[model samples]
Target chain A: MTVGLVIVSHSAAIAGGVVELAGQMASEVTIVAAGGTDDDGIGTSFTRVGAAFESADSGDGVIVLCDLGSAVLTAETAWDFLADDARSRVRIVDAPLVEGAVTAAVAANIGGDLDAVEHAAETAWIRAEESVNSGASEAEPVVPTAIDVVTASTVLVNPSGLHARPAAEFVKLAAKFRAAVTVNGTDAKSLLRIMSLGLSVGTSVHLTAEGEDAAEAIPALVALIDSGFGE
Target chain B: MALGTDWALDWLSRTAATIAVQRSHLNTLDREIGDGDHGENLDRGFTAVLTELASFDDDAVPSDVLKRTAMKLISTVGGASGPLLGTAYLKGAAAIVDLPELDGAALVAMLTAARDGVVLRGKAMVGDATMIDAWTPAVDAAARALAEGQSEAEILDAAATAAEEGALATEPIVARKGRASYLGERAIGHRDPGAQSSALLLREAANAAIA
Candidate 1:
């Protein structure tokens, strides 16, 4: 089971719409929206937030993201009411509701645990920062680690190269393994990093894997890239 | 007369009634510096608390009433006020448990705990142009009243007056906390809605004690 998510917003439509958008990429992940007040006005609700936290959780822990001030306050108050066991599993991530929800959902879809899912949501904006420094891409990828390392070279098959869906698919596969896989030296499991590489069709890149699952990770990743990620 | 459970009930009912009457006034204050929903949101919460009051036992203690009020506000009050006020009431309840009647010391303890709870929940302190500004003044006034050997009613009266003055003082300060802070220097000359509401609630508490 994936780590669940709760999106809190002052507006009902905003929260529900975010849940719908994030759900598109993660059909299996549990995402709940606790937005607006008990009367459906534009304010965060304690009851709705508490209910969302209960339903979204499936024993794998839950991460909560909120839009603004009172939303955060109410969520923290709700957290206090949670049982000790449930409290330990719930974490409040201070990130934008829309982007964070989408990022967290994709990470959860790929079997990322609570901490990884939280990181995915929190660091969703890092890709933009990397893109602005385009002059840095000419540098080499990271040197291979001392662990059991496997390396391969693969050509991009899809005419579109690597975009959202294909890149996400590649990352989902790579992240499932207990290995550190990198494409052209950037992290393969990072959706932002992988997409920021701007790999075009027929551009060959070095794929490397280290750690215990190096052999399995490199071949599976290569096959997925070769298959164009089922595009 | 001692500030007993009956006094607590009266205080809550009076506070709710006052909020219902002054809802628009609070909204106007909020509109100037904040979201303009503070009055309406607090009114809705206290109305729910009034409804929940029926569940209280006839011989309920002060702590029980305060606890239920806290829960009701937490559930009904939307926005930052919900958690802030709810935590205040919750801590207020914890401070005076098992006491059948409240004296000056007990009143001071409750107000101090309530003020601390607001700080703990909202993370706002004095000069931040938040409810804590009024609440802190009221708490310190209450403590001073107790030291001066004032009656329970006098202590509450001192707190109410200081709260009112504290709310008025917010008009010239730029907000550093809450939604009003987003306005930066523009927030000056507008009284913080939270501080105004805190003043109103304390005034009602004092009135109830005398009534």
Candidate 2:
């Protein structure tokens, strides 16, 4: 089973809205909302958090993203109440709830383990801050070694370019093998990195891979982009 | 009179009553630097605790009362206070699990655990002008009283007195945590609402001992 996510917020609508937004990019991942009080007021609920944990976890692991201070407290309380074995697999990540949930959902959607899911959630805000500080400067691209390198380039025929949905689809496909792949000089398995490129329609998409599966991965990724992401 | 389940129930009821009476004061304090629901949230939680206390079995232990209070506060109170105070009680209960009665040393242990639980959850330091300011001194004073061979009542009295002083000390210090921290220098000169409530709860604990 893939890692699941629980979004905690003082307001029910905020939590549900975050879940909906994240779910669109990762339809295969389990994302639950644990927000508001039992009476539907604006506050975090321990019972709701407890129930969310039960529903979200599928034996692999669960990651929780919370908004505000009490939301974290409520989520932690619910976590403490879990059985010892169950508690070990649950993580309460300290990150912006919305961004963290979306990235985490995409990671789980791509068959990431618990640590990979948690890492995705944790790095959401850091990457956001880096992009803001860097302004218009592009990240330095890592050139692949000469040995075992496979590469291809194609034009983006999709009308919307590589938006969140298409980026997520691309990342999911890229994560299937052992190849270290990059699309247009960025990690191909990272949804946020792909989306940040902002490659609009008619932009050139370059695919590269370095590993045993480099040959297979490069062709598959090139074909996906060539297909217009089914747009 | 031993500090047993009866004493625990009495302490909790008295705490609920005190919170109900001081609800407005707490809210006013919270409004200065927080979301202004501290008093109402605490009142709601303690009221639920009162209901839970009423259903205890005859053979129930002291920890059971604290555990139920923790659960009620965590679920009913709709703010930071809910989880903060709820964690205090939950950890306090864990400290004294299966104990039929709380002696001076047991009370010290419970208070220490409760304070540590707040520290663990809130990650606030002593001078951060949060509940830690009141709870730390109370736990320290209780431990001191127990070491001096004080009675349970006297130990609780020491804790209550120290907590009051600590709450007052929160004034004039700028907050470094919670919503008040966002205000920076503007938060000075106002007493922490959470510290005030913590002092009030400790006072209720001491009062329960005498009763």
Candidate 3:
């Protein structure tokens, strides 16, 4: 089993919505919501957060994402109350709730362990910032010509391009091989990084892979890109 | 005089009563710069602490009472103050663990530990227009009074007076932390509700010692 996630928000609707959105990309990943006060008010609840931790962790560790100041404080308080052995398995990550949950879910879907999942959640904001910066100015693609690296390019034919679903599919494919791959200068096995590239229909997709399996990883990724991700 | 479990119970009871009476006032102050829920949240926490105190046996020590209060506040406060003040009580309890009573020196150590806990939890320093603004001054005053060989009650009184002055001094500070920071220059001239509550709580501690 992969790492689990707990969304801690001040509002029940926000936690539930994030869980639903992140769940789409990671159907098998355990994502739970702990939101609102015990009285059904709009505040963080200690009981709810503690209970969510128990439900989310199924042998694999749990990553908690909180929204706003009190949510962070309450989550930390709940973390302190956890049993000593279980406490080590829980991480209260400081990241934006929505984006972090989505990226973390995809990482878990790809079979990432606790550290990998936590990094995915923590670095979600960087990818978001990169996407915003990239959106401001489109850059010309650079072709890699290194002898050891295998590279391929293809135009996306799918209507949605490399959106969430397609990005998830692409990431799952890249993770199957032993090669390290990059798509449009971003990690190919990272769903958020690929999605942050903001590839649209008819846009060119450049893939570069290195390692013993580079030759196989490049063609398979290029072929999957050519397949329009089964759109 | 050395303060014991009876004094601790008195301090908690006075704190609960004072917070209940001052709830609306604190809320009004908080509404000027923050979410306006500090009073309600604190009142709920102290109420929970009072209810939990009913279970304490007669032989319970001062640390037991403080530790129970810390847990109640942490679980029931429902705001940033929950963890901030809860950590204060928790660390204070730890400072004088198993001690049957608190002398002037023990009082200073407990206050210092409590203030340090607030600083650690909130990450706010002096003049940040937070509870630390009051707690730091109060702890400093208590430490000074203890060094001068004051009685335990007198040391608590010095802390209470310094905390009151610290809270009043917050009127001129532009908040640099918490929800109040969002107001920028507009937050100036409004006393921080957290500091004010800290002053009130410390005053209760003094009143209990004097009683």
- The CA lDDT of each predicted structure is 0.89, 0.90, 0.90
Give candidate 1 misplaced runs (Cα > 4 Å). A125-161, A196-216
> For each model, chain A TM-score?
0.81, 0.93, 0.89
Listed models, DockQ each? 0.78, 0.72, 0.64
DockQ-based CAPRI category assigned to the predicted complex of candidate 3: medium
lDDT of 1 by residue, B86-146 (tens): 9999999999997899989999999999999998889988999999989999999999989
Tens-digit lDDT track of model 2 for B111-194: 999999999888998999999999999999999998998899999999999999999999889999888999898989899999
Q: Fraction of the real A/B interface contacts present in each candidate?
A: 0.83, 0.71, 0.60
Docking class of 1: medium
The candidate 2 chain A region of ten consecutive residues with least summed lDDT is A134-143
Ranking by TM-score: 2, 3, 1
- Model 2 docking category: medium
Best by DockQ: 1
lDDT of 2 by residue, A66-102 (tens): 9987788888888888999889999999887877898
lDDT tens digits, residues A159-230, model 1? 899876777788788888888888888888887677678898999979889899899988888888888766
lDDT (10s digit) by residue, model 3, range A1-231: 889999998899999999999998999899999988778677888889999999999889999999988898888888988999889999999877888999899889888899989998989888778766866654445455666689888899999988988888889889888877888877787777677778999998778887788899988888888887777
